[model samples]
Target: MGLRAKKFTPEVLLSAPRRSEGIPNSDASKVLYSVSTYSFDDHAKASEIRLLDSKSQESSLVTDKNGSSEPQWLDDDTVLLLHGDEGGVTHIKVGPVQHFGDGSYIAGTIDGPVGNVKLVRIGNGTYGVALTGKVKPCGDLYNPEKAEKPVTTGREFDSLFVRHWDHYTTENRNAIFLATLYKEADKYKLSELKNALKGSKLESPIDPFGGTDNFDISTHGLVFTAKDPDLNPATHTKTNIYLSASKNFWLDIAKGLPEFFEVPISNFEGASTSPVWDKTGTSIAFLSMKTDGYESDKNQLFVIPDYVTPGWVIHHFPGGSSGQGTWDRSPQSIAWGGNDTLYLTAEAKGRMNLFTAAARPTGLNPVPSQLVKGGYITSVKVLNSGDIFLTSTSLIESSLYSTVPADHAKRTLSGQSYYTLPVDESPYDPKSSQLITKYVSSSTHCGGMFGIYGHQVSEISWPGAADDTDIHAFVIKPSNFKEGKTYPLAYLIHGGPQGAWGDSWSTRWNPVLFAEQGYVVITPNPTGSTGYGQKFVDAIQNQWGGLPYEDLVLGFDYIQKNLPYVDTDHAVALGASYGGYMMNWIQGHDLGRKFKALVTHDGVFSMTSQLASEELYFPFHDLGGTLWNNSESWSKWDPSRFAGNWATPHLIVHSELDYRLTMNEGLSAFNVLQTKGVHSKLLYFPDENHWVLKPENSLKWHEVVFDWINEHAGLEKYTVWRAGNVKKQPEDS
Candidate 1:
């Protein structure tokens, strides 16, 4: 059979980090607190650890490494440390240090396979350890028989058993307490322990304005930082420190102890809390949003003194007030540092850096200073001997370092031995960029059916490509593509009218995956893509289907003339969301008979209806005003006006739970297609949301769309050619 006449099977487009999930963290500081480089050689991998000192400086390693180590101060001469394995298991060890980087130390392993652990002083000469682990009825602390042992005294205690415990206080010992989620406040005594622990059950705290919540907690009062709502798929409100403590420690408060502070509704409304107590325990410092309309920045510092009015006195930091900076600066880690001085780790110069501040009066602002520049610093610990321990990271590696606060000289401690991993190179390298090309070929084409690895071709460019323009095209000659044969081209549109179709990784919208299905896919970032600049982004504002649409059409024409093998008669218009909106709009206005099929996914049909029913007013604000205010512009570009003219066969795929665009928008377009008797079908996912987050539903969505395109375009018979294998034809035969 001729190359163009062979029956081809479509290829499945798979996402890289395929079986291996992408590391869940966006910033390196969040994953590896402190980094220290050991060697500068090409072959020698560097090592690093999260340490206790803030001023310690180190270099990057040249080799590959694994896991992490965090150091904590046991005393002036000794330290308690955690060594983590590749499997995420952490081992506790106690060690002695000589100098900052003396390369000298003796250490002893204390506990193995421990989960999360925090140190607490229980009593005079005694300490209480709180951790997160499985609870067993009665198991030996050392030498467990099972591969997985149940925890008896950690965060998992409540899951194993439920019991009410009384609150009590001892003279000098620190106390550790645990409880189930069922217990209420007024049960735990807070005054008896050297330090108190509280736990919260809310996954995320709900806002007073009725937005989604974002908090989660274990049995103890340690507050885990809540992630950005946009970044995390899970959305719950994280409780304020007072509420979290009241929920878990209220049951254990002693009868004679001071009354628990009542958390004001204003504090919980639109802000989160990070509570840090002074060593004297008479004062507390917290981070909160100043919602009083005076301060627009979401991060501010507040202090509460027991002797004062018992309410918090708010103070705005340098970057805490609105218009002071462009980035959001939250105090991640804070230390007392004695002499009323406070050391904090925060994002300063586009990266995480260390800063110091001194406490003034309750209502007075503290003087701030930048202690360290660049790199991300985690936790800072000040020892009685006037030395500091900290965990920090450079662009390449993370490690533990200590320095005398007086001179600021720093040195590496442990975890300095394994800086040999290649993956620990310059932390600033564009890791996401490398994954994009792999994802494009693995999944984008063939309805995500097959995977193809290791294929190289030439760069296809446009006549006016610029330095700022990263536009590259690929051509896959059909496996059965005869010497004189031609095939239909599918100009696939990417969503994120603001998003770019670059050499970046995407779990969806794969081109190779589409190519495997026997259709040539052409995708271009018309404008408003990120990476480009402010002008490109602002170009699409209120001009959705204008110049950007022109760019797509121009690119299409360029490809058609450059690649004559494509059959213009069988061309199709396919896209989802914004892309869907473009397809619906163009089909009505443009006289393009080359495209025989149109597949729209959750597209916007009527801007008027959309502007009226959208959950928020921002979309309208972004449009420069309400539809009534911009009727002339809205009417000239609205897709609904063109719906009456659409004649191309189309398939509409929408999810009912898509609040962003909503299901009504898709129905509006479907109604138009139905009235015109245009070959059309509406596929609805009742439980699915905007992105088809579910694995099974996503697979089904892809299958149905490809089936419709193949059936309408008459490419179903050549399924094998859709699998990514093609015959190379002569340049000019």
Candidate 2:
């Protein structure tokens, strides 16, 4: 029956850091670094930040109540901190260089009217601070506590501008120079900050034909990282480097921009990130790739001398790729322990650990210094005493650990180094794991919501349940959920008809906001979800709307019968991309009368039209072959095949720049719903691409979705949770 729900055993979910880099070093053999974790509380919540000491094993928390991140150490005792709140605040805080337990930390606020501050140290004790805020007349310092007039009003700061300032140069004074946005405006305007920070400002000379990629500033000069799209074997897939500096201090001798260095193609590739220069500023060390970007491998160390002429020479260490092809062995948190020694935090065989490399431009001799099993090494930093501090996390909590060099052997710090930073570790279910388990579990609700979190079900056993066809489902219950009370359920379908729902934080398609709004949100990976092995993924090769439709129906049936607390009659089916395809499919197929409304986000309706369009060629490739070759299969599964039967009220959402699915898909779906006289609405974002990434746009998106749900389902009333204008609903014609 309906492909027997394909018995699938889900694989273990692998979690790793998305971004990691060593912080700017304050002194010789002393460097600070930071790491981030997906928040268990809310997806919108800012990542946790901790300060690590490399010399004397110790770590400390840097963020406060609202959330702190992007920490840049200004000096040994002072750090520039940025808080991720509605009004992003940037200021300098004076704190202890080394972390001590007992919850004792001394921090002094540096008063300024800057809204979002991005700080970069240009020279010794001299820093560049970028200020962005709403324009208003300069009056009393725009302190949150004592501002009489609206200081940040008028046009908001959409640009980033850099100004030279010094932290240790003045005890309590901050000397800020507001610069003009390059080319856009002249005469020392403060708004020009954004343009100067773009990759184009620090242009790359490596491939004059290669467009600007990414760039950063270092002590030696500005390093611009780029990729050549036309290169053989896809150049710069993982390794990245900087061009050599020129004789003139203002220009780089490596070619391209006068102020930037171009990285040689031979030395760069394989997902390279976080490039830093040595204390001597004569050589640069960066994470090098041993395999393709998608492969799970520990990035090896690659060194290049800054003085190498014409082209830079690359060196790989012996046994350097020891952990290659393994997810748990990637090296992170790299810093210079000394001019000759490089320290890094790594994970191997599912254990978080540390390693040291005595490097030379010719070759690297790496040695395994420490092994931290059973926990994750999130960050590492070196101290003046040659001690190493690290921030670590387990499933239960995050803590700080320290180690010091003793008799030439590194040892954990005694009672003096370990510090337990205060963190809200309230148990929030891991949505990714739940989803995985549910997909593999045998239950009668073959596809219904079963887990405690999105797309995961803990118990798949249902009354009178038989056969392995039962698909388990997971739903994220609201934070302050009541035991027996019913809540509106939002049935979410993931894109990639091939993609499965898992427990991970998505900056886009955030389900936490719905849970926070007192709604039960459900996501079912269905068949063809990745991470469950190759067979399951291959199941949906050309069966997009066939067996998958039945799985969803069975899931709905199970949820309605078992989850009485989930107002099944008031549920809304929502999805984007491929998920949107399912929504239209369900509407046309008349799968169930349970859902009161639906939302289709940039989904394909007419597969025939989509295949003919030039915009959808890549997606066609991902689906196995072109529609021309599989015309019968494509037509059979096309949502437009059953469009004439669609009667469910729906809301269509899409972005103008979404070339993948294109706005035409949403527009066509909306037009069909309107012609059929079905109750429907449309929301179009002009500036956003496939996903709404802007902060303001994200807020508006949430507001609009909630408003649409409330209008049709009679859910909770809307209210502004944070400061910002709430977007008004477009008038229904």
Candidate 3:
């Protein structure tokens, strides 16, 4: 008989506070980060900014304002904050105060047309990137729905990607504009902004993945930008380098004359992105991929000290690997260190580890020196004295960490203020040693999700494939879990097959929500996962399904055998993209019988269709070659081939505008289930893209998913109902 609705609900669980992101000050003296607060029920929630004072290790709220993001520190005294102000509009604000007292002051009110803003010191004057929207005006920065837009065609779409991811494309061009910053008696104001990229068709700073690294400023205040090579707005995404010597350099161009002072850099054989000037500003360092049309190509770190010459005097760092010995599936962000060295974080062994290399060419191969070997580190900075400040995250906790060259001990200056990093507490008496007495307490953001605590997070490792290589997985248990209590399994497989379920908390697929429903969640990073080493990541190619599937199966078996609390009979498998493909594959594998149900979100159901995807390189590289030459490899792993035998009830979610996988994949999978007459449901989001992002939609998604799992896989109470029947779950022998 069908059971009544239970006490568990998505209301409280979805409200769980999660860490939004972390940003470090230029001086490494303070850290600014945003965390989710559930004090309000709005799914379109904004994060509160909190500052961590490194010296005092004291944490204080900067902006209690509901959803701030992109926290950037201009200096020890100034910080730049961009966040949703009113009606889901992004507002940029920079202030003289270090800590948010009266709260965050919006800087764009006088700066310029608010767009994507970044602040860089240009000589004695301050400069920023914003949209003036004068030529093509950005009429609003607060509410897109009510945005007083300029009347043109008013036609929403003159093209593709009019609706990107979750929201419709705004008229804003995200151009780089100059904010006239001046000081009046100890007081300052940023106003009189104008478009700087005059006579340019390129988007300012380049997007959709561009960060602050997308553009850089020289000591002389000149700006260097890597713009996507597309001039006519093509589907293919690749970037090219451009530079402006000074503000007046573009004055002639802005007047519609080709007399612009700026010029395009050397056109390379491939895409060049993330340009940064050296300390001396003599040369620049950027990551270049030799092959065009492919985003996954291994990067070659190139230094162009002679940018003014006819072509870049390209110098390749011979020793280190692409992405600077790190696997950057996207454009790699690199930082400059003392002695002209570059420090980067690479995906290695399921961790985002730190590595460093010099800018100048070395005679031998550049094998980067691995520094911070554990946890996930991003936004690395090097001091003149060789000190490093970065943000690190693990399965359970995340915070800003500092390392001095002397001892290299990670001083947890933020989050958990552990002067003594985990597992390395000193033996000396706490009273005798200069020890920090208190830890950064979990924020109000933590202990959220209807005030229900998250699972006890930990890690596990298992062997894989023919080599029996070690694979890592982040495992979670229901809050206040007891060893004797068996719980349903929520096997959450991550995408990127290149990405790992690392120590840091995730907002999208948080294990805490599953734990709140009394389910044990296991996020596995199989053969293709990053931070494992280049060889491991490279192994996923050609053998996509062959090896990674073996790793997943064996890892699941290991977890089931080891963790008796997992009710395997009532388990449900869920994944997105690559993980989704794995879930589809699982439908045909013997593992299909182990799970009560499955969920594939925007998964790759057919390689044939994916080859024609908006992105061409990922499929071209991962499948070894083009489909014509490697038909066998493509067919061997295509999840669609196994759909004929699918028996388990499944939920297929595909966004209509998911150009990456396209909507056909999910539709095809759902069609097969319908044809086979198996129990299934299909969720189509016409507004969303590859991921569900709209707050209300995301909330509904969580509710529906949990309700489905409740009926199909026994979320909390082990009431498994499969294939339209309440399957008798096998009890402990």
List all candidate RMSDs to the true structure. Answer: 15.9, 15.0, 7.7
lDDT of 2 by residue, 1-733 (tens): 1121111101001011222334534442333444543332254434445554544525456553444545566566555554433433343333443542223232323343443343444443344344433222232123444435557644433321111111011111211122211111211112212222132322222221221122333444444343333332111143345443444322221223343344553533454544555655566666655434322223555666654352564544434233332222346556666566666666432234555655553333333344333335555556555544454433222232333242122322111221221122222222322111001111111221111222222223222122243344446766557888998888888887656554333445755446655677776666655533333444676777866777787777777887887888788888888898889999998673568888888788888666433234233433445677867777778888788888888989988766556678888999999999998989899877667765556655666776677566667544432223222321121
Q: By TM-score, is 2 or 3 better?
A: 3
The best candidate in terms of lDDT: 3
TM-score of 3: 0.76
Give the residue spans of candidate 2 off by over 4 A. 1-73, 76-225, 231-324, 328-474, 495-509, 525-564, 590-594, 607-617, 626-637, 692-704, 711-733
RMSD (CA, Å), candidate 1 to true, equals: 15.9
Better of 1 and 2 by TM-score: 2
TM-score, every prediction: 0.46, 0.50, 0.76
What TM-score would candidate 2 get against the native? 0.50
lDDT (C-alpha) at residue 386 in model 3 = 59
